[model samples]
Target chain A: MRAHNLALVLDTVATSADPPSRASVAAATGLTRATVSALVDDLIAGGLLTELDPPPRTGAGRPAAGLALTSAGPAGLGCEINVDYLAACVVDLTGTVRQHLVEHADQRPAAAAAALAALGRLAARARLAAEADGLVMAGAALAVPGLVSAGTVLDAPNLGWRDVDASALLRGVPELADLPVVVDNEANLAALGELRVPGAEQTFLYVSGEIGIGAGLVIDGELYRGVRGWSGEIGHVTIYPDGRPCRCGATGCLEQYAGQEALAAGEPRAAAALGIALSAAVNLLDVPVVVLGGAYATYFDRLRDGIEAELRRRVLTAGLAPVTLRAARLGTNAAVRGAADAVVREVRDDPAAWLRRVG
Target chain B: MRAHNLALVLDTVATSADPPSRASVAAATGLTRATVSALVDDLIAGGLLTELDPPPRTGAGRPAAGLALTSAGPAGLGCEINVDYLAACVVDLTGTVRQHLVEHADQRPAAAAAALAALGRLAARARLAAEADGLVMAGAALAVPGLVSAGTVLDAPNLGWRDVDASALLRGVPELADLPVVVDNEANLAALGELRVPGAEQTFLYVSGEIGIGAGLVIDGELYRGVRGWSGEIGHVTIYPDGRPCRCGATGCLEQYAGQEALAAGEPRAAAALGIALSAAVNLLDVPVVVLGGAYATYFDRLRDGIEAELRRRVLTAGLAPVTLRAARLGTNAAVRGAADAVVREVRDDPAAWLRRVG
Candidate 1:
């Protein structure tokens, strides 16, 4: 009961636009004022929350003391293993990045073990930097471009790895060995990263462009990982029935059109194909919004016109809620940051569990 | 506390294949045996549960009496208003239909008030039958062939109704005035009906073919109602970008090829278009199963070959989990049954709320 109430209080504060007072938290969560005060005190003592001066008011009673999450609190560690680079990040409880590092090294040619070793080195640097800034690393997660289930990379044809245990790869790294480590699909993490934006849509599709395109679905503020945890395989959707051949042995797959390799070569057909495919996705899912991440974010201007033209033509319910396309706010760092955000989310979702461990 | 625990115990009993004993319920829910017994007693006293003979076991010291949901308890009322007819049904607590009635009348040409009046008459008959069978009518829900939100039919193009409050339409019917009523999309309810079958897939797409091809997406056992509660409008997807003009002002829409009218006319292109569209949905969502309902179920043998041929070629991860296509088990009654199930689901999800009212 205490844990549930504590999480309730924390979530109320995190969601408030203006820093919430104990009284407001109680009103929002339906907890008593005294209960809210106790939880707030415990949170402050744990360095997860801090008291702030209330903002100036227009006409009201004395402004109550404001409460906000602390930037120097327990942080989440995130690592990413992509085909072209390895990256790491640390995000504080307030969902702000404090430490980040990236190294461009093509992992496609390297052995799986070598790529894992390089990612571990990057994670150590981020952890050290976070510690120096008085932040406790709560947990770590790795994002990989593959189908991941139970912390194992089931298949990553892009990286030439199959049935590899990603979490086990970091067991020898001292900085990560004692920490709770998780592995997930990169597209899932990138979608989570996009959802971290304040006032984000409740349900939207996040498309992540790379050498191959991928998508992650966020429904009702939660990731919808399908059976076998391989739901968002949008790259293979047939965009053209009798068009170009694809690596997946299918003709005119979406990846062959909208993937980074196609876009990097500055093919106008790539943008046009992306628009047609996205229109189908928009029509089928009825999602009101779509966020473009990875390479798409860098070329939003070049791609938006084509996508909009197709959407205007194909989406049947566009008049109900015009499908809005937006660039990912966090840009290319969304996956690594989303990885860190995933760890912080654990503490936010069940503050009682974290409190129990601490107590 | 008692209400929460009671709900836990009742849910465990309802979901278990064999009626679970108090000890088994305690083990499954992490409640103490005493607490489970006390909650079970409350449920039994409320006429929501029954004590049953324990199943025979190979080795057991003392066989404990098992618990199961009472089939003659409160029943959920479901009413549906379609383009072609109106339907009403009552389902008992054990998910069995106790009373059902269907009226064959073309609603498209009728005035909204007259059609609603006819539906209320049907709902009255079903409620009377349920009460005669020693069952309490808990609540009623209306399913319409259009967009619905907040118990209002937002826009049902087939019926030419817009911005109509369905609950208000039933106010003149004394049998339903005081009873809580809900309105929803027929496709959403149909998908929920399909989910009621034993051993259903965790995540799959349910396609409802009628005048237009509608779809409902189920992910993690819940309907994926997208933003504005209009997620599965698969009918609008462009099947042949240049084939046929549709009412929605789009060319070669799936509805033009796969709607009931087209299929009734024996258009081979209808099955072919359905296959292509289903392929796109299956590939993009990575769902391993697809259940065909409405008109599609009647002609499954004709459509399956075309849909499967397309799936074999388009679904990229078909090798991971073979896509299984099947006819909806409940056939034409899925919508009405699902509407009733929706009402019962409220009780199953929150038995404590019902207990509070009863007490």
Candidate 2:
């Protein structure tokens, strides 16, 4: 029953365009009026939902009460750190974006602290705004342009950061310290972001941009985190055995040939590997829909056709369902929006009590 | 209560190595004796289960009646076609293997008729065995080694066939015409086989070995069939752009690179590409567990270190749970076993009269 109710509520809110009333919930779910009231009450007590004012109906004898996200409830903050800038957003229990902020930065490791400080201030403002709007932050997630292991940024060659401790950096902000701050590769988060986008539950892949390329795979609506959390890293797939030197000390890594800066600035000859490399990845994964996002999405089309052609030649299945390649709907805000969504998942799913008391 | 009773019967049977008595089923599922009796009646009425003689307990007053899967019920077949051979196995409703058969054939499309004849002969033998034991045949499934879409094999490089009508192939056997037949990629069936493996629910990436290499993916215990039904075609990922031309007219696809024949022939360079390509794939998916079966599992040790190192280069987040890379327990039988298991899934989850009807 608990699982069923959770599914019903989450499914309802996720599918509905706007907040609904108890009567609607009952009507859609086919539960009794009393059952709807009981479920709604439980959800309210659990702090996973709120009551909103319903719009007046033309022929209604009595006005229905509305339910929506509460402003003073717990919230989540998600920050997407790209190659040259950062974007952040805060969300409440109902998946509402309360605040979004972006900042620019240098790629040097030395600039990381200053950028972190700026991020701290931006997060402080978001928390304050969330509080003003009656939502308290329950958690925050930080996505970076590198390989992250636990709280440490192990290797972000593009940023020149070697084993940078992102969790420690976020810890400097007292307002964000106590919350469970998650940090991972920006691409992985973008993949999740794309998967959560409306109507992305089937098989889909996300190609995230920034310093390097990262792919996120979702099969049947579940994230495919390969052994060791490195399932979608296509940038370093060794496109040329004798290609340009990769930051990871390997020649011919896909990043050297197709990475954002590499593809953007390198001669077209260098970009020739994009088709072969991406086709290699696509053929292996067999994802029907591929969404390109990140700082490099716009520029990626320069090589998209070649990759698709190569895929046509190499994929085992001919006449495959046309792989829909589209720009991400969330665009530049994919990571931040996805970050806020993680909180939405938590609060909506009924997390720890204190954390559960959300918008 | 109905659902609970159904789960009880299934769970009890799943847990028991040998058949259990009705009283034992009642105790195991926490149901009243009357309820257990009533449910068993329903189960027998559906063809899914039957009664059997219990193994005598040393000091028992009287032997308890053993409840077991009905051999007279519906069955599913997993037929595998490789470069030069065809194999089929019949599975009972409980997912138990009842019969297995195989034959060799030329890769020529013209030989499809001969292969169909072989299948008909095998089916006849299987039917004879089932009738000798008083069992009823239910359904059959075919696992093709190629790019299958909508009941057709569009291309199977190993088999050197294209656009072969798989659904029509079964018509060669008149007895099978009345039965439901399913056809899918062999690799996909292998992945389902892994999902049905006892005590395992983690994501599974099943790679099969026969003539050429193929792969299957299972995420969250469900087969991840891409939109075109062409997902899990890892063999065709072009790892080499300008290298050796493959049968598919592509250079450096995983199959052309590390396929069974390629690896067996000592394609040192191709073997190297195998590890790197898989490493890149695993890292990109963020799936912590990878079950390596089929062609690659034999030389897994050769590919392990390189794949792991390459994976480390691409993976971003480091989670505490270590990614598990293990060989499949079912060995070459995974698909046949999985075909049987698929029948169990359909029978157990839906209102199937075939499963419930008893003689």
Candidate 3:
């Protein structure tokens, strides 16, 4: 009960639009004033929260000090290994990005081990910069463009990766060895990052267009990872049935038409092909919104019209209600930032775990 | 608390393979024996459960009476209006069909009111039969081949229906005037019917192939209705970007290739087209199982191979784990049976509602 109350108080302060006093928190939570004060004190002592300076005395009695999440507390390390880039960032408890680093290189030709080593170095630099700002590293998460399960990259056709044990390889790096690490699909993480967008809907489809096209399904404010943790393979949804061949042993896949490479090669039908594939997703899942991320964000103005035209023609409910379309606010930084936010959320949801680890 | 315990005790008895005594239920739920006995007594008095005959005693002191769901309690009325047929059935608390009636005639040419009147007559016959067998009708659910929201049939292109108030239409029938009625998509109801299949997975995609093709997504044992109660429009998913024209004002929709009319017209590419569209659904949703219901069940042997070929080639996770394919166990009766089952489930889940009405 004590541990639960501690997390509740911290989360309440973290989500508040304005710093709230102990009296307000107690009223918001329906907890007694004494209990709220005790939990707040424990959170302050654990470095998860801090009391803001009180306002200058007005005509009333003593003014209560407002509580807020500590900026110099535990932070999260986020790393991403995409087909052509490596990136890392650190996010503090106050939802601030303290450090970020990126390197551009063609990763498809490099060995998986070599690519991971480079990401580890970038993450190390970000972590050192965060620590210098008086923040402690809590954990780390990596975003990869493929099917991930049990710390393994099951397959990343774009990178020519299959059955690679990413966690074991990352643990071998001196900088990332000490931190607990997890691997997730890049699109899934990007969707999570978009979940924090101001006024974002609780459910929508996030499409990550890169060298490879992938999608993440957000349902009821949570990522809907399908059975076996392999869903949102929108790139492989057949668009033509007899068009271009794909490396995934299929013909007429959406990727062969709409992937970044296809767009870069001046494929005039990229937008139309994407619209065809997205219509299938919308028809089947009834998702109300579609947010184009990754490379698509950069080309939103060019692609939106074609996608909407197809949607208006193919979606069954197009006449009743139009599916909302938007460009991702975080753009290419979504996956890395979401990865770091996930780690911070862990600390906020269960502060007692951090408390025990620190002790 | 009492209402919750009553439902829990009733559900425990309904789900048990072998009848269990109050003491056993108490042990399973961690409730005191006296409390379990009182809850069980209330359920029995409400006609939701009955004490089964005790087994022959051998060495024990006293054989405790086992409890089971009553077969002659509240029942559900299910009705379906398809393109060429109308069906109605009654299902009792024991999950047994007590009455069923079906009429075959093309409903597309008839006025919507006339078609509904014919269905009302059929449902009245079934309801009379169930009442003769001492079963009380709890509620009614009607299945239509289109989008339904708050008792309104928004659209069913095959039947040429748009914004039809189904609840008001059904209530206008004298025999059904007193019962509460709801309208739902046929595919969604059929999926719920398949949920009772032995060894059914908690998550799956049920395809209802008729004059139009629709899909029902079942995740975690509940139907995943999309944002506006208008999901599972698989027939409109594009199979070929520029193939045959469809009545829905779209070109190359799955319905143009795989619908019953296409098969009746001897479209040689129906199976392959179905394969392409279903591949999109499986890849996007990652549903592990696909159950072919409605017209597809009658031709599963001929369609299975073509569908499987496309799935293996298009699904990203096919190499790691193959998606299972099966024919609907209930066959053509799945929609009507599921509609009735939905009503029966409501009573089982909340017997207090029935008790209050009966009193």
Query: Which is the leading candidate under lDDT?
Result: 3
- Between prediction 1 and prediction 3, the one with superior lDDT is 3
True contacts kept of 2: 0.63
- TM-score of every candidate relative to the true structure: 0.78, 0.82, 0.97
Which should have the higher DockQ, number 2 or number 3? 3
True contacts kept of each: 0.53, 0.63, 0.84
Candidate 3's error at A340, in angstroms? 0.9
On TM-score, the candidate that comes out on top is 3
CA RMSD per model (angstroms): 6.4, 4.8, 1.6
Flag regions of model 3 displaced more than 4 Å: A58-62, B32-34, B53-64
CAPRI quality of model 3: high
Residue pairs with colliding backbones in model 3 are: none
- lDDT tens string, model 3, B115-181? 8988998999999989999898999999999999899999889999888998888778899999999
- DockQ per candidate: 0.42, 0.41, 0.86
Per-residue alpha-carbon lDDT of candidate 1 for residues A206-310, written as tens digits (9 for 90 to 100): 988887777888878988776767867777777666768876666778888788878888877777677767777776777888899988899888999988877
For candidate 2, the clash count comes to 36
lDDT of each: 0.84, 0.69, 0.91
